[model samples]
Target: MTEKAQNINLNKAKSNKKDEFYTQLSDIERELKHYKKHFRGKVVYCNCDDPRVSNFFHYFSYNFEKLGLKKLITTCYKSQDMDLFSTNNAERAIYLEYEGDKNGNMLPDASDIGIKQLNGDGDFRSEESIELLKQADIVVTNPPFSLFREYIAQLIDHDKKFIIVGHQNAIKYKEIFPLIRDNKLWLGFGFKGGAAHFINKHYEDYATAADRKEGMIRVSGVHWFTNIDLKKRHEDLILYKNYNPEEYQKYENFDAINVNKTKDIPIDYDGFMGVPITFMDKYNPEQFEIIGVGIANSGLEIGIQPYKPEHKYYRKEVQKRGAVNGDLYMMINGVVTVPYTRIIIKSKKL
Candidate 1:
């Protein structure tokens, strides 16, 4: 491989190694509680979880009867150990199936659960795992961050309902944004304080001293992506700010007034407005129409044009900071400034 290709592969491997954060039971329960109604009589699959230590397995098995679930299936990638995190050390992997409480003890018992080995390494993309996925009604798991795009595409291609975890930045991805724009997927009731505390062993904690916990990694911008509809999805955001030309700067390349914060979105403005990515959290289709994203390629798709020739020097300056053709920019005090990633939307009600 060329040096560039080798470097990319190395980086991907490093990223996948750091993608082993285990979901906390409290975090799972908090988000699942909001969707209990959707779980009734459904076959739930935790394809990325090891039944031995995964809280996703624990939560579903424990709540199978409570949720009136038809079945609970969990599969581990490779490791068979009961360790805090899997290192994928084993050549083969296993899956588990639980059908409520067979002994009537009101709890999932090991004797009642069925454990089976896979011919393959139990990767979610493996044919054996895909067979299990076909039988499931809802797939729930914390998938690997590095493989998130492919993982989501697989779920979409299979037409399977899912509530999977991923970084919030995935919303802007070319592969993912179209799904959100078309209402095929959406954000779930996210982690507390917009960050998650995951059980982990291989990474150092970068959380503040006040937020740090023993044996856990605090990852910001993590969110649950799901096709299952949420009650909050239809609730309109309470916008209090009124639009003013001085407060909201109009982008020079795109005809949209930029609002730095979601909460500050103007209620009166009916035209296209550019807002931060966090706006997705409060987006209600009835209240606003998602125009398009305002980043390079997506920006061009939404009609964002190149900088005028008169400001070529300014464009060159901003390009050094990662700006490119079709990026949305505006003059702030006579200086060319490219705004951070923005989602263009229009107020439907206004």
Candidate 2:
């Protein structure tokens, strides 16, 4: 193989290694409880999960009767081996279907669940998995982080409802940003304390010793993304601060005022305001109107102007701070300052 091909394969191997992080059962139960009303008599599929190790499968199976679920379907990717991380050596994969407790044991047993083999590797994008997705009312899983865009696209293409785990950074993706703008997707009640501790045995835990748990990796900025309507999405964020020109700096390229922090968003500012991406966590469609993103290409598409010729000298300084031509920047204290990516929004009430 050529050097380029070898590098591609090596990168894929690294991504697959990162994909092995498992969702804790407690985390699954905590998020699923809020959506209980939507699951009655519905078929739920955990497409990117191994029934052997996936807490997604365990959560639904244990609560099958309680949720009034019609069926629970889980597909294992790339391996039939009973291990935490998939070996990905097997050509064929398997799926399991559990209706409920067959025996009087009130537990999901090997005999009770119907295990079946698949013709292809059980990728969420596989034709076999798509067929199963068509049968599901809800898709819940902690899919491979590297494939989040493709994974979400498939669910959207099939018009399937989903509650899946993903990094918060996915919100800024070109494909994903449009969905949030259109209100087709929103953040679910996220992990406790804005982070999650996922079960993993492969990667080294970088979390502090105080935060580390046995055989688990603490991932900050992870959240549940869902198309399902959530109560949290509708609640208005109570803004207390009043707008002041000194505190809220106007972007030179965009018409929006830049508010450095989400909590510092002004109650009286009715005009366009650019707030940090975390603002989405408390977003309410009824209370706020999402204008457009103030990132590179997204900013340009929304008519955010490029830097003036007179300010050309400061381009090098701004670029060093990671601000490109289309990103919103401002002249702060005679210095060109570029804030992090901001989501432009306007208060419907103000």
Best by lDDT: 1
lDDT of 2 by residue, 71-130 (tens): 999997876442323457667788999999988888888888999999899977888988
Q: Each candidate's lDDT (Cα)?
A: 0.83, 0.83
Quote each prediction's TM-score: 0.92, 0.91
- Show pairs that collide, candidate 1: none
Per-residue accuracy of model 1 over 204-275 as CA lDDT, tens digit each: 666779999988767677789999988899999998989899999999988899999999999899899999
Clashes of each: 0, 0
Evaluate residue 149 in candidate 1 and report its C-alpha lDDT on the 0 to 100 scale: 86
Report residue 42 deviation for candidate 2 (angstroms): 0.2
Instruction: Note each model's CA RMSD in angstroms.
Output: 4.4, 4.9
Q: After superposition, how far is residue 84 of candidate 2 from its true place, in Å?
A: 12
Candidate 1 vs. truth: CA RMSD?
Answer: 4.4
The whole-model C-alpha lDDT of candidate 1 against the native structure comes to 0.83
